[model samples]
Target: MMTEQRVELAVTKSELGARLQTSESQVAELKRENEAQAVDLSAMEDRSNSTELQLQEHKTVMEELKSTVEGLKGHIAERPKVAFSAALTDAGSVGPFNTDITLIYTKVITNIGNHYSPATGIFTAPMRGVYYFTFICHNYGANIRFGSLLYKNGERIVSMTDWQTSTDHDDNGSNAAVLQLEVGIRSTCVSHLTARSMMTVIITAPSAASCSSPCEQKTLQHLQRLPALPHVSRRPCSTFSGFLLFPM
Candidate 1:
């Protein structure tokens, strides 16, 4: 009987030991699985951060492109028109005198903000481009001499001195000057005359042929339709008549 009891005790001890080993193995497997989950979580966090950074970069680039497009649109909208006109004189003078006469003068005349003139009859530009200008003077037949066509901002592109003589019924002579301009400049067409008589000043556009329609459409119609002409005092020395045309 003692031997049988001892055998049973040993068997029970062995079974308990086996059960403990199995439990320990299961706990180890669970710990390993938890460790794998942690690694996967860390990798997912890194991927999310990288994707966010890429998205922000793309947004910034898009905004920059939008701003660039807007700037270009504004520049194109502000491009200049081809024709314009202005009046430079305010009074009339009677015949029979010789002196230096300034016919047309103005300060606020310009085709674009890029181009402007002082009130003293000068035209200037802020940048470089092809510019056309003209000045006309009416004088009596002593001798009409066209002086300097000064380009104030840049070198003169073109000029003419003794083109031809002007004829009128009252022995008056007319002179016209055409000039080509460059960027960042102004110009003045001056005339020196020997004899004295009644005069009117007219300045035409760059190419009276090409710009005529636009000039007439945009400028001349508006100017001619002004409610009334300004009153002018008569002078005895020389009559000054001023007319501006952007003829079509």
Candidate 2:
């Protein structure tokens, strides 16, 4: 009986040792899992911080862009207004040509704004604005077919047709247009008339205080040489004129 009891007590002690070993291993596994979770959470926090900084930088850049845009708008608004007027003096007998030709004006009545170029017969807009333009052609030759056109760039925008007056009377007419012109825009007058006819064209527009291009100075220099002749004509005369109506 004593030997059986001693055997039972030894078995019980061995079983208790095994249970303790299992508990110790489970505790070590739990500790390792907690350490891995901590590392993962720390990495997630770092990424979130970087993303927030980038967002802040982008916002700053957007604000700067907005400011620059506003400044440009203000500068454009402050640009000067534009106005010009011109008229033609005696362009001796023109166009005895076999084919159609463009007449160039050598005389100008007024070029207050300096936008009109007598050299090229083109009016360049100094700024974007609504403008009024008028062109008149008077021919003193019977049996003459006289016509005029207003051109934008190289294309014909409008045409003023020829009017035949009675025998021994001058054939004269005028055409006018109100244009919404743009900055850096160009316009001109061209004439197609019969041979040996004395025709005069006149152009007029309101003058602006300042122009946006350096051509304004050249306009002044040319204006100085233009002989201030009296247009004391009882008969119809040719004229061209324009002015800024308003800005767009």
lDDT of 2 by residue, 1-248 (tens): 99999999899888888988888888888888888888988998898898899889899999998999899889767755566655543533333333333334446666756877878666777878888777665544334444555544343445544434446435456666677766766655544323433222222233321111100000011112321212313322555567778777
Q: What C-alpha lDDT values do all the predictions have?
A: 0.37, 0.52
Q: Estimate each model's TM-score.
A: 0.34, 0.46
Model 1, 1-248: lDDT tens digits are 99999999999999999999998999998899889988988888898898899899999989999999899898766654443344333343222223333333332234444233435443443334454444422222222332223222233333333322434212212233343333433343332233221122222224221110000000011111211112222222112111222212
Q: Give the backbone clash total of model 1.
A: 15
Off by over 4 Å in 2: 1-79, 89-91, 95-102, 151-157, 163-168, 193-236
